[model samples]
Target chain A: MARALAISAIVAVFLAAPFAAPSYYVGLLTKMLIYALFAMSLDLMIGYAGLASLGHAAFFGLGGYTMALLLMRAHASAWIAFPAGLVAATLGGAVFALLALRARGSYFLMITLALAQVVWGIAFGWRTLTGGDDGLPGIKRPVFLISFADQTPFYYLVATLVGLSALAMWAVTRSPYGLALRGIRDSETRMRAMGFNVWRHQFAAMAISAFFAGLAGCLFVYNNRFVSPDALHVVTSAEGLIMVIAGGAGTLFGPALGAGVIIFLEDFISSHTQRWLLVLGVIYVATTLFAPRGIVGLWTDFSTRKRKP
Target chain B: MAISTTLRRTLRAGLAAMVCAGLPLAGAGAQTKTPIKIGFIVPTTGGFAPSGEECVTGAKMYLESIHYEVAGRKIELIVEDSQGKPDVGLTKAQKLVERDGAQMIMGIVSSAVALAINDYARDKKVPFIITCDAGANELTMPGPLANPYLVRTSQNGRTPSAAAADFMVKKGWKNIAVLASDYAGGFDTIGGFADALCRLGGKVTQEQYPPLNTTDFGPYATNLDRKADAVAMFLPGGGGLRFIKQFVELGLKDKLPVMDIYAQSVYEPFLPQLGDSAIGIYSTLHYASPIKSPMNDAFVKAYFARVKHQPSDNAPDGWVGAKAFGDAAAAVGGNVENAPKFIEALKAVKFDSPKGPIALDKYGQVIQSMYVRQTEKAGDGYVNSVVATYPNIDQFWPLTFEQYESYKYRYAELKGSLTDCAKVLEKK
Candidate 1:
């Protein structure tokens, strides 16, 4: 009951935030929510499935590029471009899983990383399509979504999309299929022996995770109304992995919290001083030292330790 | 009850800690009246940070001249880092306008960011100026008139390129190779030179668009046509520095005379490090820090005293932007309430800038002189020396406004290839 109440209260705060907060904060929160969605999708692969993929941003960037092309070149509406971006990303994930899942452990990680670099090269070299390093600009929102002119409306739209995506991910993780994923994570051989198609389950999870990451990317491009090579760069992939670890990978809402903390800290700290990178490094070191399992783990440990027998 | 109490205490402590962490270090000093807030955005943390820093220094120098006050009204400048990303640029721009209450906006180090927020600046009805970076001609052309509040005081990408082409053709150099960074601005620079040279009946022996920031230029350099009389190139920022060093190391500089489009390689700060290799290299740009002029001499001296080094191309952009803004403010009697009046004042004003004579054209773009400069030993180090001057140059050079309007693309670089100019022109 407490968990449910906390969840609803958090959502309520985000929903009410646009009306109460300043426009800049509203815009900042909208960006945070999109990043939260990306981080949570990464958590699905790393936490539950025990698959540490470094190329997750490949799907994220592909989603953004796909959406930008559709909107700018094909002149497609938001409804069409948004779903098409998801499908393109899901397919991209499937292809990546086919190549990456063949390997195990460090090999899988390296292969995914290499594959993402290849995508980065394409995005960078293909000037006619991606606008090269300068990036594609002047993306217009759909006529219906033109209400995005106001910060409040745009915030609400992003909140709704992020909320639905998060709820769906949570539901999937708690389902019986989710249990099978946990079993595979613990012992893949045992799961295979128990009549579970472990590979299929892993592949499905990758697809779902990629789909959400791609959705997040679509949201990001539309929100910024521009797309650049930075979206697909290795730094973005590394940042996603950092958010997952910092938020406590196994927990559902932890990654979202981590994303919020990282984004807010970057903005706030960078504003105060030019040496923000050094300060950020110090904060990360402290977090790692104090909360080995992340902030969520720290909270859970504290709560359990205080409970009476 | 004890557990709930502990949780509450922990949460309260966290909340207090966060509030304290988020507080501003020092509050703004009391002002007699609300100062005219100008939000200055620059790429202060990424690849362009050095240039951005120099621009900020130049702007501060301008402020120092007037004691940081304009017509009895204090001027407050808020600086934000764009990180050279369009999204970050837009977000910071919006924050400055929406949250910080900035009446005027200036500075952009990335063309992509400039294009992204052009409409936003228009829609918000804010007086915005592009100072340093962004050479896309569309920014101040037909598109800007729609906004009426937007103007560019920086040199366009094709400024030096066209000047180089005209100079080389006049000197009767027939065969030249074109190389530039592979991007929109790169295309603009190389394409402008190529088209102009070809139109003058000169031959473009080779054309190459090397990827920007490529650490290894071995492949691109070796493949260039070595027999060409010279290579007219545009590689900006750190990439230009690397490319020039590599080209000299490969002995290409000795084989073929090099003419650059005022790249970062030949900029004032890089000249000492570039050493003898950069000497005798012909280049063209709007401003050379060593130009012979009373105003430029004072500006350079002031900049050297403050920065402990020579000013680069970025300083001129900043100095001009601030001067233009100050002149306009003085014209309006420090009252920025009437934005149109302020913009008109800006357009009508003509005066000598640190760069040279500066005045706004009909399209709100700076019409200034483009100098053909050669790198020569000045005192202890090399500096760009003025060789030829194209006076009163506008963004469209040699073409009338109607000719530019009828052109297929806004800029010459959009035509794709040097040979395709006639095709494009015929189609138009």
Candidate 2:
């Protein structure tokens, strides 16, 4: 009952944020939601499947660039461009999975990084199509059933989409397939011995993660109406990793919360001081030292201890 | 449990820290009269930090000169660091306008950042003045990308390069080996040189575009056309510095006379570091510290007093941008809130800048003199000593606007292809 109430309160806060906050803050919130979805998608691999991928931004970038190019260059409707973006990301993810799943642990990490770098190189080097480092700008928001030209309407669209995605992800995490993924995470050899195709499960998880990340990327491009090689950079992939790790890698809500905290802190701290990167570095160090399992881990530990007492 | 308590305490401490930091800013904002806010964005971090710092110092120095007041109203300047990323720049632009309520926005060091925020400033109808760097030609050109709300108070990418091409052709360096960093600004600047050179009956012997921030200049240095008259380069910042050092090391400096298109490699700040290697290197730009003028002397004096060093190329650009803003605001009777009137006033602004007499053309691009500078040792250090001056130069110089715009190709489209430039120039 208490859990239900807490969830409802969180939903209420997100729904009411646009009305309460300024347009700038609302824009930031929209970014936060998109990042949360991105982080959550990453969490599926890192938490449930025990696959540490460093080149996740490749999928994100592919999705964003696809949507941006289609909308800006071809002037395609959002309905066609949006789904095409997901298909592109999914294909990229499937291809990466084929290459990356051949190895395990650190080798897997290296391959993913290399593959993402290739994507980044393309985005950076192909000046004619991608606009090189200057990037492709001037993408207008789609006007479908209702014109989401305004901030409020756009915010509502992002919120509704993000909310639905989060629910679907939650349901995925609780399913038997999630249990099998956890079993593999615990011991992949044991899962293989039990006649389960471990590689197939991992590949599916990766593809699914890429799909959600693509959705987030499409939302992000719309949010800014701009796309650059920065979206495909290793820094972006690293940021997603940090969000997942800092929020609690194993849970859906943890990464979402982590994304919100990091995004807000960065914007807030950067506004206040020029030494914001230093402060952020110190926070990361503290997080690593004190709460090894993340914020969610700390909360769970505290709540259980309180109940016991 | 111990960790959880520690986490709780950390959360509390962070909140306290935020409150402490917020107090002074909150107090500063509680003024009786609402000041005319001008938002300035520059890369205070990342690779472009030095350029960004110079721009900020120059802008602040100008504001200091006016006592932060124009036409009886106080001008409150809000500065944000873009970190040299396009997306970050857009976010900061949004924050400055939507949150901070800045009447006008100015200052950007990267062309990418400028282009990123150009649409935003246009859509919102906010006056954006490009203070330092950010020399994309499309920002001011008569095309689909032309923005009414935007005006560059600095040089276009083509200006200095075009002047360099003219200067080079005059010096009989007809066959040039062109080398530039592979990026938007690089292509635009070097392409301008190629186009102008071709128009003047010169030829590009060979062309090489090394990627931006390339550390290893070994391959590029060795691959240069030995038979060419001179090597024309547009490498900027550290990459430019590294390339020159490597060129000198490889003994190629003696063999090939190097001419910098934008003076990025041989600028005031980089000269001291390059030392004797920088001597006799010719370059072209809008500003040099050693230019003799009363206004320049005053600017150098005040700038030295503030920053304790000679101002670089970007400082004057920032100063001119600020001066333009101040003049426009004053002309509008300090009512910068009157957008249309203020924009009109901005276009009509003309003043003797530290560089030279500056004015805006009909397209809101700066019309000023381009200086041909040669790095020479001055006293104990080095300086970009003025060699020659090309006065009253506009973005489209030599050719009339109609003639220039009649070409099917822009500088970007003509990248690494001097033949294409020649093809376009040959038409009509």
Which is the leading candidate under lDDT?
2
Which pairs clash inside model 2? none
Query: Candidate 1: where are CA atoms >4 Å away?
Result: A143-146, B1-32, B143-147, B408-416, B419-426
Residue A206, model 1, lDDT: 91
How is the predicted docking of candidate 1 categorized under the CAPRI scheme? acceptable
DockQ, all models: 0.43, 0.61
* Candidate 2's TM-score: 0.96
Model 1, first chain, TM-score of: 0.97
**In candidate 2, what are the lDDT values of residues A1-309, reduced to their tens digit?**
999999899899889988766678788888889999999999999999999999999999999999988887788999999899999999989999999999999999999999999999998888788888878888888787989978889999999999999999889889999999999999998999999899999999999999999999888888778888889999999999999989999888899989988987887788878888999998888888877778898788778978998
lDDT of 2 by residue, B287-372 (tens): 98889999899999998887888888788888899999999998988878777788889999999989999999888999999999
- Candidate 1 lDDT, tens digit per residue, A62-146? 8998989898789888888878889889998999999999887788889989998898888877766777766777776545645
TM-score to true structure, per model:
0.92, 0.96
